[model samples]
Target chain A: MKIPLPARFRTPVLLMAGLTLLVALATAIGSEQLNFTLTEMLIRMIVVIGLYMFVGNSGIMSFGHIGFMGIGAYVTAWATLAPEWKQVMLQGLPAFLQEHTYPFPVAVLASGLVAAGVALILGAAIMRLNGLAASIATFAFLAIVYSVYSNWESVTGGTSSVIGIPTVVGPWTAVAFACLAVVAAYAFQVSRYGLMLRASRDDEVAAQSSSVDIVRVRLVAFVCSAFLVGMGGALYAHFLGVLTTDAFYLALSFVTLSMLVVGGIGSLTGAVAGTLAVTLIVEILRACERGFALGGAQISLPRGSQEIGLGLALALVLIFRPAGISRSREL
Target chain B: MVDPLLRVPQPTAAELAAEGVSVRFQGLAALSEVNLTLLRGEIVGLIGPNGAGKTTLINCLTGFQRPTTGRVALAREDTAGWNPARFRKAGVARTFQAGRLFRDMTVAENVEVTGVGLGLDRKSAHSVAMEVLDWLGIADKAARTAGTLDYTDERRVGIARALVLPPAFILMDEPAAGMSDSEGEDLVGLVTSIPTKFGCGVLIIEHNMRVIMNVSHRLYVLDGGRTVAQGTPAEVQANPAVISAYLGADV
Candidate 1:
């Protein structure tokens, strides 16, 4: 159906509508357990699409974005947790946060801003490096964030699940934010900044010769993508009402990046498709691992099938369709 | 009615000059005390052999290289250490010998990006790109991916993109490297019209002596990175030093 929007916005708005409808379908037909699964899917979609906004446009594989997600998740935890709980369990938070709990929207915005702020500071230095050096530097950055958060016992509760946060994120919230991420990313993809960025990606020399500031443009994309992923991380904090540093570590980074790659790392459509495709496969495998009842028998894959299956899937995609299923094509 | 794309920045008595510029590599002088200048509304040809430092000179003029000694001046203002992007923003644009088109973008996008980089809004950039493409007579190929263009078309798009920068001084590095005689004739016409049509100075490096002689109002001949001759096209063509230094080896 034709959406009465500007020509520049029509496709993204339509894509958002389609995703919302799919989530609505899932909500209507499924039980509460299914709602949780759908929420997970939507949240991952937001994070992966955020990755694409930077990686796809700049052709830079960032290993540090999930660090921004962790910051967002932790910020939301600090902001939304009851003041009484913070006094007893944590005292490192500033007085304002320690004294008052904020609404969901306020915490989400704070999460995104704080994450983006950190990205701006770090990306200034990181974006100066290129190719393999940039990749390794980002990886090193991710490790540093993980270590700091894991050991900061006073503020972070360190290496353990920080609980007592309000559980406000549901399937609907997840769906709404996923749609927002999709639209925002699309708007950015066609913006002049995005155009200059993709130009640099194709040929750094050509883009510079055209008067593009390559480092500055990459940093802009970095900060913008961090904002989206940070909010996605905040949703995750409320989804389960617990924050664990492990959940925001290397495993999360690789899984989200794999979704981007397997779906087509070059296009936003690939980000969405990769996340959905990989999430469904893992969920199905998890169900089998739990032993599904078959004809007069219980049949199941062995334990730890999900991780193994993900590896094989990524390997197969790289071997046959290295560009991913969408092949970087936009909607 | 004049097209908006044609209404570029005023000529402003602009002059892009390399004064006593010298570049040395590991104690070897690549360019020794070379000086050249391009003024608004004039076309000058720079002719040299393979290692005559023509591309290196273009790099110095356009901010890709720093001369070991001496400074480049734009409009009589010294450009001490400007980078390539800064030089481009100051209305000096150049194209590579290799035709470095952004392979992933469409032909129109290749030009539009330069316009946008030059601070035009997206809508204006697109219109300017369309106008430039139309003027180049390749408007039909606007939607084709740059990587998919044939060799000749890549060169055309390269020139089109440089023009979209609205440059006050343009340095082309072997723009007519590979083309038929008829195609070369068309290029000669295009080079000739650039100064009058866009109010920009042109410094073209082409090995085709016939084409360069036909298009240039004046010529600067470089052999072994030093000026062999500099004068009106006729004056330079008849100089024994230029014929012996350049045409002797080339033809």
Candidate 2:
């Protein structure tokens, strides 16, 4: 007799299969023109999936995920930039950072480690407070990181931006990492810690009575999510061939959060669908702005129209389909 | 006529014990100087009027509320400051008064979450959940979301969730509050067999007098956070103290 898959795993397995097909289709159809965009979108999916790990499972919102992303981007930028270029780009940098250039993979891994370490410290304090307080604390953390990245000019290229990083993130690399992220999230959602976190979300009093450590569970999810998001940021930094603190600002944070909310806050498929849909929508909007001139004037749909659209979409989703588009499946 | 206090048997070695346990919130005593023991292989009914501190005592024992004074020893360990996850690892499980099922999850998923801290693998945990559902006669509703279940099935699902963990001690808070007599009987039957079938201790806080009288091996009556009476069904029924507390002293 064939052993049937557990109910929980069934949806995740189907989601993985669907994601694999999308990756394959992206590879095949967009051999050249759409390859770069596809890779970037996949990398963004990684960050959003990481966010889903904590927010989806624990029912807590976090604004600190992008701070970890910023950390990863800068770490990867510092580690992978050549010594001669770094010496010129960052004159007052320490000798070790100015002298060594690690391989891209090593730099990415280091970025994730550093982000996880930061998350561990920050989550200890932030995870203690729940609801809006925790959300605001995390947002404040992002602002703090943004301030440091902007002011610390010598090492981080401070506001001016860092250049000459090798472009190593191609379609396959992005697809592979995205797959890794999805699998990690799947494993975590089914794990003991994830169950406890969800239990805490469902009923705090009963979860406590059952002896679940809510803080510890939240911290685990937070750190794990940060690590993956960091890796995704590192990939984005490498793919774009440039690094800047601006790239990992509040805009990016809001975008990723929108992806999670619009897709389905708690399900994996929601993360993927949200990322793909939001990315495609923004890209199409940008294309429309470039392609069509409104009333003989160059079509400029304001500076942050993309953000406004995403915000409106989020509000609409919350009001109409509160559970998200893929409410039934794990995705 | 049997003396009310004489009919109830003393707790056995495998029972759950609490000594001088007190839970205070902002200087208000929820449970003060409370001492109770629930024996293994027996159903102990905890009955009290609203706000008599029955739920608070249950919460303290199950790790939801930390006692301000004294300790709760389950099986053997001092569980005074233990959190819920730790309590589950120590083989203690519980159900809530309102039947807090995972609204987004299926009935089977609800049960599977209960087996999470049992050190069982996912497949094994799922199998265990299915078995519990089947045992409760709700296996057919396994695929349905817990939120959509009828009140009766939801209560069954709650019981199944607790049973999936196979805990050494189960704390049930108002299992029959909104249930019909038939439904309440079914729940009572399910709870009474837990000790024999799963070899676990049960401490139930209940309001339904018929269910309590029918199922509980022993009963403790709480009035104003104090144990007003403790005895068998017949003895408790005859106890003037319990009767006065329940029906007022006009009789």
Candidate 3:
């Protein structure tokens, strides 16, 4: 009857600790290339977990969360870019923005805040719509973010990648944030608000009859998810040493989404597992494309095998286990 | 002039009243000028044949459907166009005609969410959830997925969810449909006990006359979207209009 807090968090905490340990071990024993791959994988895990926080809990498929990531990347770039570089590349930025630079942590936190602010504004209106209509509204949101950031010549460099972003993030940094995202996601799923949102997701009429404010609960999830996804974008910008709207657009969106579905769209464990599995598969296929030697003979996979293999694997997994590997089960 | 300042004492019990409530879809009338009242600690039954607008009446009372005419009042305040959540917060709760439990949640969670939604903290909500499940004799099924419950258990779970709110008024839509005779008797026991045990008024829309007659304190009969009769079961059974509505008038 007490609904003990620690007991509720056990699954998510264990999963987070387990992921962190796995990443640490990989960083220790694996080659530099593996560390790089693991870092990217961990970052993707954070983004997908952020996606799960909204999509899994609210039973709404959002195609626009990558837009939040885009917002985060630009905000981080705006905050951390050297003043000289900002003036030369981002001349469209106001003088105050172009003239100042903040610390890395401040830039990351600001990235999340800025993205959350945008999501709150959009979610206030978008959460009112349901079903495919809501999905379309989010898709429209993504399109708007893409177009604005792409064509905004002076501020975003007009389709050219913004360079000189310090590569400050590494494997451990990714692990830390991914762990934070997982904990935040777990905290949300086990909270009273999360339960209410899930109830609404299961049945709107019943939840409303129980006095759950569906719109408000959904907005909470949307904003929280955007905040984390925004942070993930910051991590990406620092890792890549460059910022591009294209990085957080359709390609990454589909990839993150596919990972979520493959891992199980219903649980936090699924988000991490799916990202790791998909990233590993992609790396293997890329290696195959690079002509790995086997049995003293050179074997070369056809180009674009990663895409074809990923698509085939996702199709097969869905066909066999429609709920994904975890089927909503927590770690 | 004498000072007019005075404070009125609170009403002893909550009351839900509908006056001349009517519902129309396009040009078709589903209910016309239907009036009903439910008071705390009372059990009332609304009975009718299929398509008698019984569900439509439930929808209007619970604020899912807004009547084109008339007012639905909570206590003395008119709440005609209030949303379902508003109705719930005002202490009105209802079970669906079919138990629409949160499919992904466990049975306990299904009940706990209602308590949480009604502003109970986690501990209190969990306590209420466990209490309701135990009261309904389905405590063992607390951790089972609500969607996997059998028909009878699902119905019990629905009642348990409604009870978790500590509601002042609960409207049940066809709670005994598809139930066996013994199950109907069990339901009669449950419905009869609700007003006294839970301290809430009940408005049950039931097609089965046996359950309705055995449990309800009063009965309102509807026919063709209009009230045909209202009285004690014996009185309504004897009324010719009520008889004609269920059977047919002499041709």
- Work out the TM-score per prediction: 0.95, 0.90, 0.96
* Poorest lDDT segment (10 consecutive residues) of candidate 3 chain B: B2-11
lDDT of 2 by residue, B21-111 (tens): 8878898877878888887778889998898899888878777778888899876668755777677666677888889888877787777
Task: Enumerate residue pairs that collide in model 3.
Answer: none
Expressed as tens digits, the lDDT of each residue in A1-331 for candidate 2 is 1146666467666766776787788778867758878888889999999999988998889888899998998888888899999988887677877899999989999999999999999999988996679889998999999999898887888899799889999888888898889889989987878887887788776566544677888899999999999999899999998988888887888889888888999788899889988888788766765566778877666656666777788899999998788872663
Per-residue lDDT over B97-213 for candidate 1, one digit per residue giving the tens place of the 0 to 100 score: 899999988898899888888877677788888887888889999889999998778988888888884688889998878878788678668778888778899999988877888
RMSD of every candidate to native, in Å, equals 2.7, 6.2, 4.4
What are the chain A TM-scores for all the models, listed individually?
Answer: 0.96, 0.92, 0.96
Question: Model 1's lDDT to the true fold?
Answer: 0.88
- At residue B114, give the lDDT of candidate 1: 88
Q: Which ten residues in a row have the lowest lDDT in candidate 3 chain A?
A: A1-10
True lDDT of residue B237, candidate 1: 83
Off by over 4 Å in 1: A1-7, A293-299, B1-13, B248-251
What DockQ does candidate 1 have relative to the true complex? 0.81
DockQ of each: 0.81, 0.40, 0.78
TM-score for candidate 1: 0.95
Q: Sort by lDDT, best first: what order?
A: 1, 3, 2
Which scores greater on TM-score, model 1 or model 2? 1
lDDT of 3 by residue, B1-251 (tens): 32111121112338998889889999799999999988899899999889989999999988999999987888888885689988887788899987999999999999988778877766667777899899889999998999899989999999999887468888999887888988967876888888888889999988778778878888999988998999888998899998888756762
